[model samples]
Target: MLDQQAVDAEEERLRELATALPDLQRQQYFQQLKRELRDPDTYAALNWCFLAGLHHFYLGQWQRGLFNLLVFMAGLALLFSPWPWWGLLFIVLISVAELWALFRSQIIIQHWNNQIMRRLLQEYSSAE
Candidate 1:
């Protein structure tokens, strides 16, 4: 159907993004991470490997990273408080969201790389 075609197109785009130069720049973003230590794919996987917000932070998405972190902290607080059942439910929700983020990491990284590439390309072209 139409959705299948869209998926295929997105896959093609991701393949193109993988070889793009902005992927290198994305890797060099965080000084603490070390330029050679983290690539786009690895950064994306870190979302699940470390925390649900880690990837977003790597990508310079402050709002998303903060939101996820805050939600997790609140959930942990609730877990030890009187609302144990609510905390469990929140934890379950976070787990599901994390799983989704883990599975979609490749696509997410590709999308972010594409954006970076576009901006870099535009800047390079404008300078010329």
Candidate 2:
């Protein structure tokens, strides 16, 4: 639910500002960013394959991941009951809801990385 152009422009602006830093400072920025950056492909794969919000965990979104997992487990519990359709429907609904992330994973992870970069930059600047 983000504007692609705006997010991309912000990332570009951040990159430019980073490049203007002295060599050592810029190196530190990149090193930290590299360690923090999450891979879109991996997130996408987890979302697509699991459809259970494991992808959120990969990006350090623990609450969302746990919520999804709990719901999925509840659905599974319902699945074993006499009314099997309820569980099936619950699972399908959650899967459908989460499916959007599969398509927009690249942008999602890019935004997350940008946030990390922005925070690191702010920390470096404020430390001075």
Candidate 3:
């Protein structure tokens, strides 16, 4: 079995890899997207798919992330309930809200990762 320290170190490394992006390539993609979409705010937020706990998986928090994803999926499944249509409608409404939260969380995580990558890259390039 791996020791706690070793596990911690591995987790840290994985988190770094998860958040690290190719600066030049990412910048080029961002620029292209910006040019195509005149509204900056529209693309500023993180993608809903990423926010749905995919970032957590990237950071090595698989269990927590997976749990959240399952919850979201459950909520979606609830929309198909056979009870009165009202129950289904209510579940659908709740699912929408959950989706919104997932989207917001993803955007926050992406911004955070971008900031960290930017700093790391700046330091690495400057040192060379």
Candidate 4:
């Protein structure tokens, strides 16, 4: 249940720590832990093998999860639509899009985590 506020607060705290800390050893350890906390491989597996949006939810991306869920539900509805041919086409398109997402899941999540880290570092530097 990581709400936006909590995530923001934690980022702020990490920024503060980054500013106050001068020990490279400690900073490296923190970075390692952060990477472990958001392992891209694990998230990719979750996204592809289980729920399509589970990785997004795990990363505190509720909106992304919601969007994926809605799209998936719409695809499911199309499965029972009156126009079976059109519905099948729609489902196929959605499934293709999903496959694209699955292939890019690791890169996407890694990029997101990197952005967060970079932003925190920038904030820390500015605070100092």
- TM-scores of all candidate predictions against the true structure: 0.66, 0.95, 0.32, 0.60
Which candidate number would show the highest TM-score if scored against the true structure? 2
Model 3: ten consecutive residues of lowest lDDT: 38-47
lDDT of the candidates, in the order given: 0.61, 0.88, 0.49, 0.64
Flag the better candidate by TM-score, 2 or 3: 2
Candidate 1 residue 107 C-alpha distance from true site, Å: 1.6
Task: Tell me the lDDT of model 1 at 81.
Answer: 93
Ranking by TM-score: 2, 1, 4, 3
Clashing pairs in 3: none
lDDT of 2 by residue, 14-94 (tens): 998888777888888899888988999999999988888899889888999999988888789899999888989889889
The count of backbone overlaps in candidate 1 is 0
Model 3 CA lDDT for position 106: 35
RMSD (Cα, Å) for all candidates, in order, is: 6.5, 1.0, 11.4, 8.7
Q: How many clashes in candidate 2?
A: 0
How does candidate 4 score on lDDT? Answer: 0.64
Q: How far off is residue 52 in model 3, in Å?
A: 2.6
TM-score of predicted structure 3: 0.32
Q: How far is candidate 2 from the true structure (C-alpha RMSD, Å)?
A: 1.0
Candidate 4 lDDT, tens digit per residue, 26-77? 4764675466457768777876775546667878889988777666667677
Candidate 1 structure quality by residue, lDDT tens digits, 75-103:
87899999977877776777678777677
Candidate with best lDDT: 2
